[model samples]
Target: MRPGADIQAFMGRLGYEFAQPELLIRALTHGSIATATRPDNQRLEFLGDRVLGLVMAEALFKADKAAQEGQLAPRYNTLVRGETCAAVARDIGLGDVLKLGRSEMMSGGRRKDALLADAMEAVLAAIYLDGGFSAAEQVILRLWATRLASIDDDPRDAKTALQEWAQAHGMQPPAYEQTARSGPDHAPVFHITVRLDDGSMADAKGAGTKRSIEQEAAQKLLSRLEGGQ
Candidate 1:
């Protein structure tokens, strides 16, 4: 069933009053919703993509004083990547409020990565529209503060990247199991197990951000599998 009250409560929990409530509505509204209602989020998705890049670029610029093209490029790419944003958005309550089409709803569009990522970007654009640049900046920074802080630092983001790396190497890639995620939402530690395609497994503990730790864990797992340190 449609969870309008649940969505309202979710916004309440996020501590942001949606001045343009329709903006949030649009963010939560999917293509499925549009066929029955008005326009879908496609245009908003395009606009949001640009807006997200601009916001991340600005954040990167402000955060890294000595960042050059080489270092800044990866950070910028990672910050705006659909996978990363989808993970972050899912961590929030965005996944819960999706209003999907009946066909899409049955197909589980609500849990799909593409849908989740776009919703996050659309939500950012909505915030930008509602409260000018500064208001949007504040909200974006608040959400992306960790990514902003870690730009200049050379840290390992092992788990997901490692899988991608393995896949690039023509390997079937690895699987990660979240053994645990402790602490509050803002500060959480993850224990992820990396399992190779050959049925071999390696374990590692990562500190700092979840993505960072996962990468570090993957690196360690890769090294162990490859007979390194």
Candidate 2:
């Protein structure tokens, strides 16, 4: 699709036409394509991360009136975490509008989980700046509606759940190793493998920080174990 057409279609999906389309442009620009004059979306991603955290925190607080701080904490983390953000981005087709450098584009930057997640947050920040908090909140709540409704009140993160499972079964804790790193430094792809003492293992790939990759890998391994795979 044409870039402009893709952007307009993306705006329709987001349910908010940008008052300042430049903000949306900047949000869709990756660091690889950025120059001294043309800025990237990193700053917006930072702000958006905070915005997402606050919205999720308040949401969890209100949704679980009887939940203690400890109980609500994991749910909040699960909701605002990078993997979750990327999933939302995919659901909303945010990747199609992403502007990437030649190298990144050739290497599947649009499909990278980390880049998509960051762009998703940047888009949120752009909406916040273009409209206001209420507007951003509305978009986030709508986009994340299904996730919010099905969120566990006391969710255990994948890494923690794997560790607990290993301990319970008298196995060593799951070990994660970074198998690969690709794409540009600004939007790197991480490939990780998680292995249990019993030789069961699973591999997962994601974009973003190594820790997030490990968490995803652990989750995959856990799922395999539970499934008797």
Candidate 3:
């Protein structure tokens, strides 16, 4: 494939094309690249976070009219969340296009979920800037429609999954306690501890609702229990 061919293809899948290729480059640039050495994607990521959220909220609100805010919010969080973005980036080969510093490249920054998610957000910002909100909405809906569509009030809940997994194994359900919280009230980093009845425990950190954080902590503990190293 040519240099930006895959990116262009991804945009094609996204139903928008950038007027400026530099916007895409900036989106793919990591903070490890440095502002002095290379203007990184931080500003674009900031813009993207807002744009992505707006697009997602509108889609979710429109799709499930019977769903209340309490029910729809967490599902919305997971669809645009870091893990989902990282999965999409890997799926679309965005990780290979990432421009990282030597240290970051060596340290496996390309595979980092947080970075991938930020890059995805930056890409959304770039699309929005180069095109418009319509473009950004196109990117978001393309990436997130399936995730949003599959959500409901039944077996898909993270808390429910964690509980069922534990119960089936003849163990008590995982216990979650909010260990710490910081940042402004609007943006908090929730630290949650997930403890199994058998004394197994794992601490996971995430920036989102407590339900999301607890799900993360439980997922981590589940991984360790299932013998993931």
Candidate 4:
């Protein structure tokens, strides 16, 4: 069967066309909207995670021949992590085509990082199953070309980097506290503060998971410290 206009547009953004359009539909199907006959994307997500890891590992390995495992490992992690996948999904407007139940739709499922990431992986798996490894690799490489080119040597997440900085300066590990929370339960905004032992602190507000807000807060503090504030 042929895909609708929206799906075609999505494919245009993804730079891949599905031979079996049903696979793309299935990949966009979330558990909330899936029936027994029309399974969810969870299984595809599982497979896609491994496929993404392999592709990223190979890409990192080939990108820097002289780099050791220590250097490549972090870069691989940075690329295949859920946040990166979610960012890629957002770039392609994957959320706009997600098939969700009323509850999930009301709860803002499209904007949820975990949901977007899972769907992104499922889409990758669909591409793999529809075409072949080469096809999936090509899609991943194209989608992640910018990230692949500019990944940091350390590639540590902000929270980890902040803790290391504190340790290096003879201070205790940074602490995170959720100072405020508002909005509805399903879509809440969090205010987080990251404090160091030396009385340095930074606060940030984010709409999503508390962990993400903590990371933002840590990044803010890290940036300030690095700037000699």
- Tell me each candidate's RMSD, in Å, in order: 7.8, 4.7, 9.2, 1.8
Task: Supply the global lDDT for candidate 4.
Answer: 0.94
lDDT of 3 by residue, 100-137 (tens): 88888875677667878898888889999998898778
Better of 1 and 3 by TM-score: 3
In candidate 1, what are the lDDT values of residues 161-215, reduced to their tens digit? 5677678767787877889877744345678777766666766564445455666
Q: List the residue pairs that clash in candidate 3.
A: none
| Candidate number achieving the greatest TM-score relative to the actual structure | 4
Residue 121 lDDT (model 3): 83
**Ranked candidates, highest lDDT first:** 4, 2, 3, 1
Q: What TM-score would every model get versus the actual structure?
A: 0.66, 0.80, 0.68, 0.92
Which 10 consecutive residues of model 3 have the lowest summed lDDT? Answer: 151-160
Worst 10 residues of 4 by lDDT: 206-215
Q: Mark the regions of model 2 whose C-alpha exceeds 4 Å error after superposition.
A: 1-3, 167-172, 177-193, 196-229
Candidate 3 or 1, higher lDDT: 3
lDDT of 4 by residue, 1-229 (tens): 9999999999999999899999999999999999989999999999999999999999999889999999998899999999999999999999999999999999899999999999999999999999999999999999999999999999999999999999999999998888899999778999998899989999999788787999989898999999988
Estimate the overall C-alpha local distance difference test score of candidate 2: 0.90
TM-score ranking from best to worst? 4, 2, 3, 1
